[model samples]
Target chain A: MDERFALVGLCPAAEQAAPKGRRPGKRPALAAAFLALMVLGCLLFPLLLTKDPASMDLSNYAREPDGTFWFGTDTMGRDIFAMIWSGGRVSLSIGFLATALSTVIAVAVGAVSGLAPRWLDALIMRLTDILLSIPSLLVIILLQAALGRANIASLSLVIGATGWMSVARVVRTEVRQLRTSEYVAAARCMGGGTFHILRRHLAPNFLASIMFMVVMNVRGAIVAESTLSFMGAGLPLDTVSWGSMLSLAENALTAGAWWIVLIPGLFLVATLLAVTELGEWLRRSANRGQSNL
Target chain B: MCETLLDVRGLCHSFPLGAGRYLRAVDGVSFRIRKGEIFGLVGESGSGKSTVARCVMNILRPQAGSILYRGVDVCDPAQFRANRRMLQTERQIIFQDSSSSLDQRMKVADIIAEPLAVNHIVPPRGSLRAEAAFQLRYVGMDPAYLDRYPPELSGGQRQRVAIARALTMEPSLLVADEPIAALDVSIQAQIINLFRHLQAEHGFTFLFIAHDLAVVRYLCDRVGVLYRGKLVEMAPTKELFDRPLHPYTKALLSAIPIPDPRRERARTRFHFDEAAFDRTGGFVQVSPEHFVLGGKEAEP
Candidate 1:
């Protein structure tokens, strides 16, 4: 791959010690503040929810919080705040784990397929396109229906399998651009194998895009999980979630007991908003990396 | 007698012309590059000059012919893969656009050290930083630049980093494909002089490929002219310039724009139409080490 036609080997010694100019931005500060708050709030859930979320009280059913229960009671007399906290772990885990797993798979597959020879690239891209054409929700639903009764793992698998296409596409484009660069050619000249180059150079260089995609994918996974749970296809009935809470309270909305749905809905919206904001921040940073010239 | 380090024989490459037709980019091009000498490849755009360089680098596989290094054919995939480490250690390349060529994610030190690490020429667990710094110094860069990214550096600096990376493995032959084309004219001279000085100091063989004849004239010991994937002429620089056997070479020489406005006004530019020679075959020798493809030898 000795594609390098000319090499420049002289650096300006006089300017070597000069510091690079910095661009001003407050985005990092905002992101740090939000993330810190989220960590604190999430970490306190177990300590806050001492009682089992499914524990029922026939006597205090639908009682508003006055002294004991802080967020009032559901139709089964379970605490609303306690259920939200207890259920947060599963939803957050599904979102983070599914996104991470899918991203890793996409990066590996895309980098290899993208950097492969023309025929291989064509084959991989065609397969990717076919996969992408299948509607995500429908695919998840089909897998769940075929498998019969989806658990958290199966739900994550369904979401992750369908969610990889966009990441793969993004990585493929990056690898294509990078393959034309001289360093990759230089690496080839140095007897670095295909996998070696991908692992050492291509993967590292494509990190900004990969990170941005992962952040966005996490948000997407969260929304997908919520949707599946809302439709009664995600998690079991024993598991409590923001979506399940809303599903249960949907019938009682006209009975003047609006607190059951309102609280969980607000939490879901807030969580989604926070994740979307984080994704935007990551995307901005990735864009800055791309515009380094 | 010079030892031939690179021997390119009967090399031909082509792509689909369209509608089941194919166009040959390099046809039966045969030449030998000697160790410790800079061989210049000069041609206009679409002349397949760069294609020849690409073929030698194994970036683009040729349709026919053999590229031999040290008396072994490298066109075979098995042989090429088996001897890849040796090939990389023996030969390296620099590109036209330094910015596009350099990996933006890498720090100056890591970029320079990549060749050494990839080749395993140096111990992996040992102090690569110290060795990288020494190599950087050899290329006129200071130790302070080890941490800076490519985007933080200027064009010339980036190119320097690129060169440093190529040289880290101590390759005996370097292929430079218009190294200074992307830089400012002022910076071009500096980089060109740097290359000349480095070649002289290290005694490294070079295949200097470029479109600028003037730069080729100043830097190369011997020059070869290519037209549409065929070598039209090859001669010592002085001999070729003084008495160009090929009409194409003559036309090319006449086209070098004089840097000075007054000199430009005083000079006559040669007119050339590429289509006029389309019907002709490949190059034929008219003098010792000099040739032209077309039949025309008479002055216009």
Candidate 2:
């Protein structure tokens, strides 16, 4: 009788479980392939393509697309093809680094704030509210100006520092919810200290949320870098980045050399789309994995 | 009488509801559990039974109280910290919700071995898996469940795993806060029987908190009735059921339906007068063993 009841209860769950085990969908695979190709191109293009991005050839200046140059030439006669790839490496690196730094700070602050006492939680949350209220773009521009330069390192730092409030808020909420979970309380009753409970129970349970924040932060960082560069507060003029290219292309666009603006703009949009798609796929897979477990 | 294993005196706890207002969850509650005895705390939902258990486990810092575990005042911050590790090893808790109590990500073996690993209780080169398997068997579960996650198990099986995990600590004082409340009625009996068997075999003290008066009568040696964050009555299991002194106790006891329809229909349900009972007076002893709150004053 008990076995029959158990089977009856498990039938619906088993049926629900079937879909999770099915083969991966085509869209996620395409997204993953696209992201992988983009990442690989960004990493290798600057090294393999020997065309100098800074060298000037007056005869080729503002030339249209031809057999010699795949993306034509900019106003300075620099190969737009070489410039795009080289700038991609810097832009991608900034996105990756800034997201990593922000995620680390956010996780630490969120975990502490959520798991700490009422006073500490209130203090951290109030600080987060203050930081969140300020316009992040303004903060980043001011920080860039104060730092005296907008190199990759300082640009990444500025974006990372200003972009952590939302991530912190997300992590704090997740950790607070997990803190009240019976498993966490049980861990405490089992002689586990605060750090042990946080590391073992709370951290693993909330990893999907952290991964989500990481993806969002990366996209935000990329966009913020571009916005700053457009405003002349991101990477210096000599530095190669998608944002820097976009900044330089404004004049080229006015002169009717559309390829210079259009090529980099397409690359920027494609990269962001690929990242967003891949992040969505990853989060869905993570959810499926948890459900299966 | 057996030596007192846990003595809680005037324990009070409250939660802030914002705007300088406080909701008192436990109001000056006091009780004691004898060594190797199952002392059940019975109350309706929101009656603060769990709060009292949490206070006894030192999970919640009570506003004002003294909890003496084996004669050591666990409520004192300095003393608790000084012996925190030892105290933790000696006392463990089992929550009501089996699904929420066990970490879903952890396998049965890891969950069971967690306490042993955390307390550094395992011997050098000792196999945690072996100990976990042993605990599983002790709880009448197969060793095959070692690799299974909590989600894979049924409610009863999950609760059994929770019991196995708590047993791994070999604690002297186990605070089971409605451990069987979430299980199906059919499964509740099995878990309760398992608890009774284990308690007898290990001779460990248990603070069993439950809302079911029948289950408490079946498992606990002594039972305390709680109403509105206060103890209304306390006596040995049989005496408390046979002759409940307090009006709230009478109401609670009468609420338990009899199995036979004829007797159930004829029974008069006791109605407790909440407004009539004054809260200013302390518990008055009506008999040598039983204590009742808000009872008639003793005659000269």
Candidate 3:
């Protein structure tokens, strides 16, 4: 050993208490719990509700909360309490379905581009770049108009189609890098087939890299669906949803019924915040211990 | 069995630098490895040692030359495809950096058993985990680490796992490209000793690439000195160390430090002059097992 290093005698383990790859902070925990409650309530609580979300009561139209109404009524006199959870089913489902569609499209595009020859890869990347360069809202509106009248299914498809470009680029870069990593080359030398390498080595890493994106895509899809509905691009006014409720409540806003829009808006922002926090936590957890390697 | 397990004739390769330029990494280099013998290739950084190793392992295709392993010409795409499984099974390579060479996502057991799983071969030890454990123990590793990922282990442990993974296939030819270069000095000795034991007991053929002449002398049956992508000298280990002929080889050997203070002070370094190097000279056979470049034909 060098005499200089020997004299230092190695610093004691004073910094050991700092720990490595810490757990998610308090905010993520609270967000996770909130999301869990929302999902459970939205998925199951409507089954027990006696009041119909679509039923109207003109006598209590836009009335403040009373003994009979928990969240009061909107301009249509529809019960807001019943509407929130019931509409939650539509909004949440569309969000998740759109997220799934976008994820599938992104994975396929990324993997194909990552594995393709130089020319084809360049072509695919150029297409993604062009799509990313455009404003996603304009594309979504244009797609919704082109796809005919929008419902939950078409709304999700449009939102998913427009949102996949960024995630695909991210996935493509990661796939290209991991595919050429030395270990993958070693596996190839051992005659490990494409499927074996993908399933055993590549898939795990891809999952870690995309977990955050996948969660964020859900939030993006929900927001996109809301924006479309609010702009009268899709979802007929009859079907109940947070966005359609906001649209119907527009007249109520002019009538000085603040609770009509504020309640659903609060729910939307809360869900977005919760989802973002949980996504960040998932991303950190997936990437933990990586630098140590 | 045939004596010559591997033979390379006039191997050459170059990489394009774009704009119609080329970097000649390896030029007409050739050597043969007999079955069960350790062949050491010593060279400085950027001398194309890794490229040569990659060519031998079929990881890189040489532009010109033929590589015959077990009488199969692996350079031909058709021939290689036809015997891909057999060729892949019988030869394996260990890279220098274990961190990059071993899949961090895989458990040690999976990494060790991957070749068998890929080849559809039933484990000789009854089960995959059992086979993995046996190989792990064989390479001087604890079986308890079978469930651990590569990131969880120290550098030496990871290299040991890499060795175990390579050995699991029971390959006939193992190419190690400076495997000990990234290890600590204490770990280097342990790894070298382990390699020596593996060769002496199992009669494993090895292609060991290194610039450390001392380790090459201690482990290699024969030595080949590379200078700027060309083999300058090749001979039996003892013969090469005692009498290095080429200027580059002399300079390379002179750099080894003697342990004794008096001898270390008395030693004079041989300076290699690049300008004096004869690029057109062919290899001349000075003895049955010795060859040197830029030399007159022997009086024989």
- Computed on alpha carbons, the lDDT of every model, listed in order, comes to 0.78, 0.84, 0.86
Scoring only the A-chain of each prediction against the true A-chain gives TM-scores of 0.86, 0.89, 0.89
Per-residue lDDT, model 1, residue A41, is 63
The prediction achieving the highest TM-score against the true structure is 3
Pairs with steric clashes in candidate 2? none
- Which is the better candidate, 1 or 3, if ranked by TM-score? 3
* Per-model TM values vs. the true structure: 0.91, 0.89, 0.94
Show the lowest summed lDDT stretch of 10 residues, model 2 chain A: A7-16
How much is the TM-score of the A chain of model 2? Answer: 0.89
- Candidate 3 lDDT, B212-282, residue by residue in tens: 99999999999998877788889989999987888888899999999999999999998989888776788
Query: Over the stretch B1-300, how does candidate 2's per-residue lDDT look in tens digits?
Result: 779999999999999999999989999888888999999999999989999988888779999989999888999989998989878888989889888888887889999999988988863326999999888877877688888788888888888888888888888999999999988897898888888878988999999999998899999999998888898888999999988877788889999989999999999998988897666668888787788776573321
Better of 1 and 3 by DockQ: 1
Candidate 2 lands at a TM-score of 0.89
Candidate topping DockQ: 1
| lDDT of model number 1 | 0.78
Model 1 C-alpha lDDT per residue in residues A84-196, reported as the tens digit of each score: 77667667777878897798889877887887898998899899999899888999889888878777788788888789988898899889988877778767876777877
Worst 10 residues of 3 chain A by lDDT: A4-13
